[model samples]
Target: MDSRFVGIADLVETPSVAVVVDVMRACTVAAWAFAQGAERIVLAESLDEALALKARHPDWAALKDGPLAPGFDMVNSPGLLRSIDLAGRTVVQKTTAGTVGALAVKGASLVLCAGFVVAEATARLLRTHECDSVTFVVTGEDGQADEDLACAQYIARRATGAGTDASEFLGRAAASRAATELATGVRQGVHPDDVALCLELDRFPFAMVATSEGPQMVLRPCAATSPTDAASI
Candidate 1:
């Protein structure tokens, strides 16, 4: 299958598979939630929609970040997801980039969220399917370079059988604005551990794919065993 690294504006025309990336944090948090056995994750486009979903399903956990309303169960932090026991609980997430990008794609039959944590496994899952082309959606770009672009570049390379080894990509991500802010205590409500977790390559042996149920975009994991797999750092 062919692979192309594109921004969210190109979301309209995707092939059989589209992997949305927000490696700075959103997809990282979602990956950890799945790793901790979340039943399924819902992506909400707005705070009101997320609150409405929460009102309907009171048992489900609601998470939000990036200037959303304050009723969410937790901030959308990967560090927070690390400590939660989310087994069988539905996760409703609202974020500026990741959730929005994941939900905006209308053409692809399958949409998977990508981060360094699940990079290789996501690529492996893509290979299992018979696709003519795949698009890696980089959500973090805002007229400038960002970590999500770095991640999408890496995943696209690996998905199209062009490369292996994540060191170079990881370095670029670590030096990106998001990682640097967290490392320097410039980004509030975020910890260094969260950025650290996001940079660890191939940490999860699964890919998080977004599927629609009615009007909601719910995410589920597709797992595979890896020789280099380690659950935690």
Candidate 2:
């Protein structure tokens, strides 16, 4: 690993792990999907691909397509996902930027899904390693704004033993400007409340992992050895 930077789609090779982020919607949706009891999420970079996966497993799958225009199954929204029941079922998701962003780093040596919700767990994951370098790839945002950059900086600070103050970092002028932009029109498609939900740290302990079965993303709820015992997070 050589250098670490914000932004997701564009990244170079490294011997260390790469933290993939889709903060605006994808990661948030994944978090909610798990919270609602989804067995797994198959993240496809393309809508057609995700649909195809559903076609293969129609008996037990549903598709959530990102907002492109109007003729899609579902727009990437955590609220919409929350309203549905997915217990013991799987979700096939396709997002314009997030899913594609994850696929972009398919060749990396180590790739892990991340967002503000699992920031502490992400820090813990980083603590378990001692590589020469680590990169947190913040997808969708081009690094000109605070959302992804703030998250990237947060991860980098964790990796380097530096302090992380999220609100302060996001309170900068540039970030405020971006917030204005997001409010006016460019990012109106995103839900502010859901964004806040995704930023909450450590509501779950499971790290969303991509596997052959699908994107097995969910909180592996603590298990109690016996009926009288309490479960731990």
Candidate 3:
């Protein structure tokens, strides 16, 4: 099998599978939302698209570029979701990096979103799908973010059956520039708890896969194999 890593600035060639990583919150939040019983997630490319989605599904949660809107149930922060109940509801998400990266890799046979939460599941899925070539896409805001790169490396290593160390990977990601900024930006509405949550590796046992339906990118959970089964891959 062949695997390659591509940052936001680099153009990605469609491989057998495209694994998009956004460790600093966006993808992490999506995993948490699904684990919390969200029906499905609709990822939009822009704030206007998110708003239009909200207009169509008034009961669903809408998240744009900034803080939680008046009518929206939650923002992009995983910490914010801790206070809300998303059982059987849908979420419309638009972010500067994660969702955008997910939408960009349309040429791949499969597009999966990866974060610390779904790293193991992602690796198992690639092995199960028998993907000979995989592209790891890091959704960095300015060329490359440490957290995203770290997550990409971790997933690649795990998928390739290399020596895997979850603690070391999480430590590197937690100390990244993006993590530090979010942890210290409480006044800017960035919560330390949110950063903490994003740093937790393999918190969920499912991978988020994006499938195109008409003009929308729909995200759903893929049940992962057991840790023992994943390690044997």
Candidate 4:
């Protein structure tokens, strides 16, 4: 089996499995949410859709662009989820890069969200499912984000039976211009701790797979213990 790394702009054909990476925050947040017992994560491509979903399911947490809304449980920050109990809850999330990149790879046989937290689990799932080919899509900021690219390469290495030292990748990400800016300044709603969370490799034991339920795309645990429990999560 072989895996290829590509940027969002170069995603022309979907492979057997498409692992989407947005390590700056989005995918990392999703991974932590699942680990903290989030029932399911529904991805919305736009703020309008996310708000509409939240309106229909008021109990569900909604995360959109910009600051955390007054009524929403939290924004797209892993640090915020640390103290929150997402147990048996469904969360609706909208992000600038991750979810959008996920929706773009609609042709994939399997769509899985990837970050440091779920990297090992993702590789295990890929091997267990025997995917002949895989595509790692780095959902960079506007173009190519170093963090996303590093995460993609790490996953690629792991999936191919090559051992991964996440520290190297994390070092690259931390030194990136995007990370440097975030660390040096106090971005109003952005938290530096969230960046730290994104770099924590293999923190969770499960991988998040995107599945279509009716017209919506939802993320659920892809482990053998609850393979068919998409509705439950």
Candidate 3 lDDT by residue in tens digits, 1-233: 68778865686355668899998778988888887778788998888788888989898888754576665556778777766777788999888899988888866678889898788888888777777888888888654787888888888888877778878778888888888777777324455588888987788878888888788898888765431221211
Give one clash count per candidate, in the order shown. 0, 0, 0, 2
Task: Judge candidate 1 at residue 178 and give its lDDT.
Answer: 81
Better of 1 and 4 by TM-score: 4
* Candidate 3 positional error at 134, Å: 0.9
Task: List the candidate numbers ranked by lDDT, top first.
Answer: 4, 3, 1, 2
Better of 3 and 4 by lDDT: 4
TM-score of each: 0.89, 0.75, 0.90, 0.91
The per-residue C-alpha lDDT of model 4 at residue 101 equals 82
Off by over 4 Å in 1: 12-14, 66-69, 224-233
Give me the overall lDDT of model 2: 0.57
- Candidate 1 lands at a TM-score of 0.89
For residues 79-192, what per-residue lDDT tens digits would candidate 4 score against the true structure?
A: 777778889889998988899888878667789898888888888777777778888888876547888888888877887778667789989988876577657654434676
What are the candidates' C-alpha RMSDs? Answer: 3.8, 5.5, 3.9, 2.3
State model 4's lDDT: 0.79
lDDT accuracy of residue 51 in candidate 2: 65
Candidate 2 structure, TM-score to reference: 0.75
Model 4 residue runs over 4 Å out of place are 186-188, 224-233
Q: For residues 32-136, what per-residue lDDT tens digits would candidate 1 score against the true structure? A: 888777878899988899999999999988888743346678777787678888888898998888888888774569788989999988877776765568877
